[model samples]
Target chain A: MTTPLISAAERQRIRSGAHSGPTAGLAPGHVQANLAILPADWAGDFLRFCQANPKACPVLAVSEVGDQALPTLGRGIDIRTDVPRYRVYRDGVLTEEPTDIAALWRDDFVSFLIGCSFSFEEALLADGVPVRHIALDRNVPMYETGIACVPAGRFSGNMVVSMRPMTPRDAIRAIQITSRFPSVHGAPVHFGDPAAIGIRDIAAPEHGEAVPIEPGEVPVFWACGVTPQVAIRNARPPIAIAHSPGAMLITDLLNTQLSVL
Target chain B: MTTPLISAAERQRIRSGAHSGPTAGLAPGHVQANLAILPADWAGDFLRFCQANPKACPVLAVSEVGDQALPTLGRGIDIRTDVPRYRVYRDGVLTEEPTDIAALWRDDFVSFLIGCSFSFEEALLADGVPVRHIALDRNVPMYETGIACVPAGRFSGNMVVSMRPMTPRDAIRAIQITSRFPSVHGAPVHFGDPAAIGIRDIAAPEHGEAVPIEPGEVPVFWACGVTPQVAIRNARPPIAIAHSPGAMLITDLLNTQLSVL
Candidate 1:
């Protein structure tokens, strides 16, 4: 059968185990969001954390407790099934990676769809600024920083950032371009001297493969989607569910619709 | 004698006196610009230079040859005498710093009012971001960079940047804030590592006083208004005039008017 036109409902149907896999390169131009579902008791603090650290945890859509529909992000998106892969966490420890969460869905759970770097990368590419990771066919390098995110209750951690190698001029232009999309990680939180922010080595990335930094290129970093995941780990909600790294909830919303500017 | 409200009309009337000293703190909230008047023969190349290097030469207003009126930028702005002070150049050398240039105004001259940092600094101050130069009561530091500006005709030189020091968090916010005003040096060109950009010493500024960069504060640099002056000197326009450093041409346009978003 020919690959389907990948609408939001179609993706959700696939996520329901009509199919199951990574969501990258799935829906083009539409927003694919990082997902985090948490207990209602811990939801307030996580919301506050997201608010306090907006760059890292840009909220695209938040669903009511126990409600599966994220109407704003997509038409008839069932958060429990729309995401292709789910990582179950219990007391901050990973418990399982499931294809479907229907059996685990709880009345006290609230879902959040955070803006992803994919949207910004799309924007960067459209603007003619090469995103080194996409060009090299690798994941963007991510690092844990010494810079602390403002704490909210039990949810607190330093920002996690994704790095892109580009010339200083391109970096400046990238900053100007990204600032237009505040919902998508905004601008680079820190650049130059990775060790200054506690990253030990430029080539030795903590999360993803490092791309080649051309001569005269600096590593420009943006607050990452993984940051809220860090806060989730810190908050240690009795039970939490997140989309697997690189696996995301495909939303019908256009990326351009998220720009505050 | 009491200071009249100095309507923009009134200010222009007073400035046409050809003997006013400095134009600082005058025409508050309205945009002020750096003047760089060049011979008509060199105007096309200078225009290309400004286009190629927009961050440094944000041309807010330009005048037709020998016409003193910059109708778009201000009400009845005469390129000849409305600016409080003017510097005359001969063979790329400063020949005079005259208050009035009507005596020296040539029929073949084309005037350019480049956007100045005062507009963005005003925006920053209004946003409650403490500008170190304003706080310490000193001029902002300026330095020549190893970063060569994109060459246009005879106009090509290293960029000159103005520096301000801020903590990383504040720097991030400032980058977001300034990116809104593209006409006025939209965003910072460089931050951290003064040496990386070829500054021999951060404390020893080439042009203005160095404000203290406290512990943990990274130096942020913006493409400066002085950049055009450097290019003008390099281009060696036979008959040119510019505003005395820091003494800009205060216009009737509000700073907010320059913001595209």
Candidate 2:
């Protein structure tokens, strides 16, 4: 069957349990976001963490306490049912992956829609800069860096970065293109030697599949959406939920709307 | 005596041969440009070259043939007498260094005011990023790279790049800051290994003095204004003129005015 044309249509398919796959290439021009749901008591601290470390956790929109709808991101975006898949965490440990989290919805839960790298990746591709992982049909390689995030209450951890192999020329263009979309991780946090940021082995990433770094290409890194997961793990608040990796909340917001330029 | 705060006053001093020194750090917050003058016969090809390779030869203002006044770049500015130093070339050979080019001005001469890296360097320094060469009181090191400039007519040569050694963190910030000012060699061309761009000896530059690269620092290269001079040499126009090394034309245009954002 042909893919749905508009975001609301695609979201309806996801909401109705007709689409449970990763939402990477769906809703071509819209913003797909990283999700984080926390208890209201822990939400204030998490909000502060996002503010303090905007590069990694750029909060696109935040839901009111106990509200499942993110009004700012889309029309009737019911957080509990709109995402294709969800990861439940209890005491900072992964409990289960489910198609829907309606049964586990909490009144005190606050939802945060963090900007995703997909927005900037679209920009890079549009500008003729190659995204290696996307070209190879593999997930972007992510690594845990030694760089520390600014501590906010109980949320603190080393920053996680997603790597994309590129020549220095393409990397420069990528930096310029991505800088326009600060809401989506902005410009790269690091480039060149991976060990400089404490990525010990370039081939073996802490998360995602390894992509080859062709000859004369450096591994350019951007702050990843998984960073908040690290923060969530550190700030264990009894129970929390997030979208399963690659199963982002496909919002009605256009990706171009995120560009500050 | 304290330096004059106004660009017109500074230009007057330069016109009277009172301030015949390096234009760097002078007329703070104003645009200083690399000056290039060619006969009307060779101007079309050179203009094409500048347009084809804007990162290296960003033409901020171009003069009408035989008109020494660059009214667009500054108020009442006479290119022939306002520059602190001028180098005249005959058949691609450096023939003389003159404080004023009024004696050599020809009706067929067409002048171009090209953007200089000084505009972005000011932005970097203001943002608290260390400019190594500025701190050491040395000229920024420039090297000829194997990267070729897009050929326009007879003008063709490898690009020349200016190097700045910075830690990866500061380099990322520099990339963002410089990207805002495209006229001033926007963003870096390459960072990390010098050999990657064909620079055999980082310590020894073909033009400008070498600055020390501290531990944990990588050399960042930007397209240099000297690139056009190399193009001029390759084209070998019978009569061509340029600002001597370190000497530039201080224009009334504020550096911030050059920022695209």
Candidate 3:
């Protein structure tokens, strides 16, 4: 197995335009965050939404308006160039997928570094809890749940959850392990029957590739980082930018630093 | 509703033979322990069994041989009298149910105060997670599982688990809440499927009354204090003592003090 790059080195590679790919497994112990850059006009509402629905949108760090650097998350980090790729959305529609957002940078832009599942997934793996999606080499299954996010100002949308199949034994351990990292969605929101949460079909996921659930395993669901993206889509801001799916903002903060306990 | 007494006052009543019924809901915030007194020769192995199976038998306090007071648990607490009632067993068969064991106490006896679910259950209720059995005024259903405890010396037996049915939402919260109190069985051992853990029937439990598991609810199982009791029976010690069902030993220690966090 190849050794993973350090968070700063990986961010440096991405900043230099030498690496343009998914950030998964890039930095072994560092936190990789979901990116959401919105206009200053919409940032406050988005912040309120995150505050109201913390499990789904745990805000790790927020950049000052017109600032490109997230000093708290990492040293010398540039929001414009550090992410491997960025998706520019215009009026809630995807306008372009760009390697860098320098050309489209606006003075009113505010960056949000939301806690991603990568942190808690790392915690789960460290505790010997089997994260099925990682083992199967597949994208974690995600579905649009009937549970609605507590609306804040203009943002309103249903929650989107990521699922991992685990036996009840493993699920219990996973819950204890993940509860320590409240910033990374904390413990699971639901498990067992899918219909109970208004997900009609377990095999057919609305967002990511479906993974097989063994006979004795229950599909444990955690609030996904994608929930914020869905809310952004519904809010329909004039201009918004986010890291391309899987191309997260690698931060200097270690996953262990997020543990509330 | 009847006002509950303080821990010390409740224990005083029990010791005075004025309170011989169940100890549940008597001293609300205090930690109530399951009692196990055995001959000094058999105590070492029983302690090992508890250490090996902490999730099922978390030892809160163990007494010195011939000592009746658990000073660490409560002030002026006598194990022989603090408990509401005690069960005397000879050669694995229960022989008597006494209000106090002071008359039966031997100089070679060693008292063990094992954590009971009451501590975590109080936490769960405080956190607004409904404990089904408690709400229904019935005993929490318990079953014998095929999962065997690690044997230490003469003690060996399959684990016994107590079941509490909950919706997936409540189960997730309950797991997080209970995990904080590791001495009180910690988090649940298994959930979702009963057969997965060798439980033949959900409705028919080996011990305690069965409560309804409404639609959308799954049965969550926690490693029970009774696990050591089963081991005690299998060990067939010449003389053994345990707290009568629901008649726990009231401790001065607050339930919140048990939280590892």
Candidate 4:
């Protein structure tokens, strides 16, 4: 009753309609995932898309067709009710933001849990690398780059990246730290001049608030979880669903378990 | 004999005074090392200096006082004769360049073999990261930075770093690749604007030939093995010796063996 401290407990509270906010600081050491649900027909291509663009969309778990339970990520994880918030999209347009997808659940629905930057951000913070957005109490700046993701059947789009401003020294250490967590956006896709990656204005971003870049600090970028969402939107399927921004599924898997090294 | 194909064979040839030139391409997959031999009286401080500034002076192995063999690095490696060429420093001044130090060998001479950048450069090339200096057939540009090395005893000086221009994408990849070889200078110390590290000119370097930094490429800098040499020169021991520039000690250890991961 005093705000669940464990991932399973937090998920249970969310499932019972108690906690319906962002899961940012919940279950501190556990891995939180971005959610995506699609019809079985679109699942194959989405899976291929995740495989092809792993840095942006590292697939953590895929539920069997129509199954609400993701047994691989955590015990008793009901995809329909476990996430704090969800966005129901029809024909690539957001039609509803629901706390539970039980009413919209279809037998053809397939759920995927993809790696999120939160895991690597935890790592960066643990290593004393300042995450400017988090410190400034704002969202990490998100930019759409000219860099295109490898196409998979019906899924393709330019890679979307989240930027963190840091000095060259911290950026180098962040690269090394994140390289160990390949499942969660891995190392940075690019750093320095954003123009090279096709971002015209460093002060402006397509999504999220732009954090201030102090003098002598360069904006380091990592492929973002929004990238897969972008691909899903571009594919324009009849129906799709994803967790509402910042409202991720708290998984039982410890973040340390994701360090490939 | 036909240009001895292995590291041991090459060492034997160098011992016999047959091969006295730079050892850049010879024994491709094996680890080559920069050499520094100091009298036992000055060796303790030098060892401490290497320990304190590992990234700049990664000590591969240190020899017993008065002993000529470095059994740890390679079998039958006679320190006095294994290196292709040697430079004797008298009171921090260059006094002689000799193929073999048999005449100058002293019972109190303690040899230190330091990890060279060649190992990481090989790793970089293998990963398809273009090393501009190598591609342009010039020495990697080295600069004296305002970044100070942690002082040990009488050894203290600003760090010396070697620069290689690479695209951000390639630089990111290079950082990952080189991070695996911690013994060989590990990852880069700095990148981007040279002025941030107190270098006034990018076109002219204090040591080594300056390679052109192409459009979209950032100059990546790594802690160089020359740092210890600079410190040693400042310490001004009565007598010291080192391998002639680029004429390293060819070791039997494979470069891949140095990978910490």
Candidate 5:
């Protein structure tokens, strides 16, 4: 049986156990976030990374050192187990993707929840602009660009961009809609010539499946959360963890509430 | 001789004599608008036309039957001769380009002042966004798009778009800035490939001179005020009048006051 859409409290309860899975279509209209955890020793650098590269890592909430609770982000959020799923990293390499992070918890671990494009995509869809990849039931196409992010501490890498094919009219409206939600990717970074930003091929996305573009449409690009993942790998932190792609943390905050105006 | 920038009263004094000339760079910081005077019998259709295409024809003020004064837009404003130049048309064909229209004033005339992109372009330049056309001292590149506007009554045509080349980063920021001034053309209608909208060549514009596109820059397109002129021609009104291109009516209203937020 398909699981019914549940309330935030109930969803958190499900996530507290072994029910970790993709948070898509769950808690509709509520904001979903990407999780990034690091040891306190590396927290300062990672925090700098998020601040310097806000489009890819819009920091929604951060917990103090040795703290597992993030009261500001949700109602009694247990950072160690609240995420639907998590990736565990050891010596800068992903070692495991687990449903529950209780076993991997450390006293010095700090948690950060970042704003995700899922929120702005929902906003765009609500405003009647069709999101291509979502209509085709595929992941949005993402690629690594030659354009470099600002280096902060030990975190820096070429930016990762997500692409959506749209007619020029819809693309303009999408830019207006997404710009209001600056915490999530904001307006598109580039359009038309993908190679101008260093992507060699339009059909060969480095991170996600490519969707078909019509003859009269252009591929609009936005900064992607994967940029931070690349930076994390480059930084080579002793220990780090992040939510697996598409497996985000469904939060109590409503997406509408994230709009600055 | 360069005339001194003057107030509403001073401009009115000069206009009272039916003085006609180009109104470029007049009354600095004050808003200038394009005029469309249609018979009262055809006013509703033209209103619908403007509503169907707000970006091209943002209605700033409309005068009542037999009233030539545009009080809302400026003090003691007379639609008959306030503008520096005018183009009078009959059966959709240009019949006269007069500076003063006191002799052609009619009781059935209903005047409209639509927002012009000049106001927002000034704002952009002031904000340090490089406006290529202005820098090159030429008209902005404009194209006839294959995209049809929402038809209203007898007024319908493909939209006209103006182009400027900008880097991806500035385009993102420009999107945010222009969104605040909806009274103007608002946000860009398109960007990137000109051919997507049936523009065969970016280097050859239908109206205005083409500006160079830097290696990493993309052409950003905004719905142009010329769009309404195209629609007006399609409507083929028995009698019509508009401000000559770049020869708008200087008004007392400040451009900054037009920001909705």
Candidate 6:
């Protein structure tokens, strides 16, 4: 096999505060994760929320209360400093965006690492299936769908889906490819008519910039990683922290290892 | 495993000239094939056509010239009389629909047994995926699409696809399931807009009865076994024979054995 363009060296650079930005397109072939840190008092509800809405928030690993290390995901990985950036939320409001959360780490803080879409997108591109937004160098279009996620305790909200435009033939292959990696939002939640899932305007997305849908192409939607952020906002815990958009926690795990087939 | 609804006894009954009609629901777990027999002179072009249009004419077995048996498909299976009904065409024109072809059998005749959609439909129904036409007790609707099959020698024509109405979620699961059985048409070629593939009237199919598409359901189209028949007519072979519509050759091979994964 060919050598990956990036390696674990990038994670070391990020750990040493040399890199502080979105981790997208960095450390190719590695599993990058969406991070969520919460107080132990609220961890139970958050874990239950992930279990209920698995497609949206497939939990990869959970740290012990007050522990900053995630040994299972990577070698000597420190959750407080390994990620490029973090967003601090206080009572559901954005409070701070920090590079290192060591100063603010609480004794009862628990870290949750959830799977991201990069893994399956890698698989799609490897199979020669075009990912429209990625080709155009734009964030994947995200929309709030009418389909409701199963609620757990205080976490109750509709699902958020990320969209990619593809021809019907490519979409079928994409479904088969993505189904093997259930940890990163398995098979698509919907395809074709956006209105069927309650998204009225194709040009206007709720979160990311809208990408062009070429002739003979239909927008395919997958459950988004942003769903947990929406659930967290609904829950309104006393304190919570998550990775900044696209600034993920790079892990030692290889993305291809996640394929069940 | 529990006993199949129809046993190998049905094939015995058909061989003994006791049964002569459509074999649709006769053998539950076994494979049923669409048969195409042609003169040795035309066999090469037909085989190439099947190889070119695999999704439409997936070849399950091919008999040697002058052979009347298909040993690989079943024990003591004689292709000449095993099928309940046969349609004989002379110079591209339908001449006779006969119960047995013993009188018309030629030493230079070659038989091609192609996969049928019944195998994958059984898999889909077994996995709890609703097949609309089956629920309504109607033939699966088939349409001629603008998508042309790759021309092989004298055989060149547009593809014929069968339609099944399913919700996007169910369609995703069905794609995953059907992909396992590539010999039986594999995954859907297209879904949603029928006009994208050049079918103008969704209600009026060229063959089979049209089943209703319920609200929130889209028509998923798979390459149809009828495609080879159309190709044969276009080729205008001096002599050709095929099984009558829905009157298939039952094989002892289990449908489950066709799954690649």
Which prediction has the highest DockQ against the true structure?
A: 4
Candidate 2's displacement at residue B33, Å, is 1.4
Q: What stretches of model 3 exceed 4 Å from their correct place?
A: A1-5, B1-5
Query: Of the pair 1 and 6, which is ahead by TM-score?
Result: 6
lDDT of 5 at A172: 78
Better of 4 and 5 by lDDT: 4
Segments in model 6 whose C-alpha atoms lie over 4 Å from true places: A1-5, A16-18, B2-7, B16-19
Per-residue accuracy of model 6 over B1-261 as CA lDDT, tens digit each: 413335467877887889988786777888999999999999998899999889999999999899998888877778888898898888888889998899999999999999999999999999999998889887788999999999999989999999999999899999999999999999999998999999999999997888889898989999988888788888888889998867899988888999999
Question: Which segments of model 4 are wrong by more than 4 Å?
Answer: A1-5, A16-18, B1-5
Clashing pairs for model 2 are none
Per residue, candidate 4 scores C-alpha lDDT tens digits across A46-144 of 999999999999999999999999998888899999999998888888889999989999999999999989999998898899898899777678898
lDDT of 2 at B140: 86
| Chain B TM-score by candidate, in order shown | 0.92, 0.97, 0.96, 0.94, 0.90, 0.95
Arranged by lDDT, best first: 2, 4, 3, 6, 1, 5
**Model 4: lDDT of residue A108:** 99
The sequence of per-residue lDDT tens digits that candidate 5 reaches over residues A1-261 is 212244456556656574676666667787888788999988998899889888878899999988988777667667777777778777778889887788878899988888888889998898899999889888778899998999999888999999999887788788888988988778888877788889999999987789999987878999987777788888888888898777787777788888977
- The per-model lDDT (C-alpha) reads 0.82, 0.90, 0.89, 0.89, 0.81, 0.89
lDDT by residue for model 6 over A188-219, one digit each (tens)? 99998899988989899987789999888889
Q: Write the per-residue lDDT of candidate 3 for residues A187-233, one digit (tens) a residue.
A: 89999888878899999998768999988888999998878878888
Looking at the true structure's interface, with contacts defined as alpha carbon pairs within 8 Å between chains A and B, what fraction does model 2 recover? 0.79
For model 3 chain A, the run of ten residues with the poorest summed lDDT:
A1-10
Instruction: Name the weakest run of 10 consecutive residues (lDDT summed) in model 2 chain A.
Output: A1-10
TM-score of chain A of 5: 0.92
Count steric clashes of candidate 5.
0
Q: Is candidate 1 or 2 superior in TM-score? A: 2
- Tell me the RMSD of model 5 versus the true structure: 3.5
